[model samples]
Target: MTTKPAINLWSSSDHAAEYLSRAESVPHRTEGESALLEFIPPSTRRILDLGTGDGRLLALVKGELSERLRSEGTSPRVEAVAVDFSPAMLEAAARRFAGDPSVTIKIHNLDYPLPDLGKFDAVVSCFAIHHVTHERKRALYAEIYSLLNPGGVFCNLEHVASPTERLHDEMLSHLDKTPETEDPSNKLLDVETQLQWLQEIGFADVDCHWKWREFALLAGRVGAS
Candidate 1:
């Protein structure tokens, strides 16, 4: 079998540190995250968070689910697995979920196939996955499909490609940067192509659920028997 490309930046300390420092300041991220939460079925039991930087998105999702369950007078618990390649990010996630028996943090690079962590009711990712090459992204989506239980949902709050070079430059300009400053790690793909890939992989109801410039929330669900 052929080996896969390694996730380089994710294993670097500086890359993980830089992302964590700016993670909260990304424009329209919270809105996209909230929209992602809305796509997940409230009855979801287990979750898998891919490229879970500092476990931010997973924390948000778990917190929301907790509140909803509390209000409904139900004792539903969400078991979660948060995966990342960076040691720094893994440490941060461990600290973030310290003493929380519900979350399990694992260190795994997205460049390779997902581990046999079992199936999940919902799988989520945020501002991650684009670091992998386009081919790997497609393959990873297939792996995600295989790991989801029937009727499970996949929600990704992602960074997508701009429609034109001018628009791409404009987005960078808004962030006070240029192409040179753009993360070489990003392998941005168009939203349409990604949605099509999900559908082709047998995910139903696939769509770009929310969009703000180049940031978007993509969602889909597997059919239940």
Candidate 2:
């Protein structure tokens, strides 16, 4: 007898469409996004956004950088690369960034090794990495570390596992979702293990920067310049 694979509906057009409709309303999402942006410095020249759904967070970050540049009355060039695997999501992001010469959108899955896209000053992901298996999550963290330049930062506005099933259910309830209705693609893991993995892998200043229920920001620096 053979066991079937886990269901990941993100690749489905309907699922991707459904998510885009509710993407803005996730509890404290803006707060999380705001906190994630603070870590990225204005001096960053290259950015990589992983699992960049519809390029929303990527756009926000770029916008913030632009605002900063405007305030300083100096314009510095910033280039961004956004990656996602779902065909529907890829199209959405490409369309979202269409005619924007600064952003380059690519299609790539998080379950596999990342493509050779050189290095980035900052790497970011928003609630997208938990879909991969727990083992792969650690490996991906390592890969992200390798892809960063010294003094670079990695910011992840992530969905993490609760300490108990009861808390997990409560979190879902707060989001107006139940176990039966929740996305089967989620493979949540505890924060401690992930932080430990980051430290063990040689990251500096690693921590869960902010959190609300299951939504948290995991950030780490590559090294001091």
Candidate 3:
């Protein structure tokens, strides 16, 4: 029997638009996002947002860091780089960060190796990355590790695989989706395997910080020493 080829449809404008239209309604996602922010060190001065669709997560991180700094009476300007492959996403992200010299939006696909955009104090991704094959996911994690400054953190708010088919279907139902209606770009992996991969990649303090059904926040840090 011939195995069907893996497919990713995120490059299509219609698909990208459709996802953006409903991006806000993903259940318990805000809780997961809040959890992910706690891992970011207060001293972070630079950030990289991978697959930054509309710059939403980046905005939240930058805002949180700014607020934290302001409270301490030290406001060091934060710099951020937001990357995405889809033209529609890029456009939306550009609009979101417009006139903000702190954020730079770039076009890049996650299926290939990430470009050398310089090291980051913190690297983040949300509901992205899983668009690539499992092999690429592991490789991308390694690359993300390489891109981090020593002691920097990597936070990925992701859509992961449920352990059992029954749970997976149930998760879809919660999202008002069924298997046939879900995005074809999603190439879900189990959270346990992904957390293990982070540990194997030499990330210290690795763990799943938060999770609700198929949604999760996976984070780890480079050794501070």
Clash number for each model:
0, 0, 0
* Predicted model with the maximum TM-score: 3
Residue-wise lDDT of candidate 3 within 33-135, one digit each (tens)? 9999899999799999999988899999999999999899998899999999899999999998889999989899888899889999999999998888888
- Tell me which residue pairs clash in candidate 1: none
What tens-digit string does per-residue lDDT give for candidate 1 at 1-225? 222344356678998898788877877788998899898888889999999989999999999888899999997778999999889999999999999999999989898898899999999999898888888989999999889999999999999899899999988876667999877777788999999999999999999989998898988899996
Q: All candidates' lDDT scores?
A: 0.89, 0.90, 0.90
Give the TM-score of each candidate: 0.95, 0.96, 0.96
lDDT, residue 171, candidate 3? 95
lDDT of 3 at 15: 87
Lowest summed lDDT across 10 adjacent residues in model 3 is found at 1-10
Candidate 3 TM-score over all chains jointly: 0.96
Comparing 1 and 2 by TM-score, which wins?
2
lDDT of 2 by residue, 50-69 (tens): 99989999999999988999
Ten residues in sequence with the least summed lDDT for candidate 2 = 1-10
Query: How much is 98 displaced in model 3, in angstroms?
Result: 0.6
By how many angstroms RMSD does model 3 differ from the true structure?
1.9
Candidates in descending lDDT order: 3, 2, 1
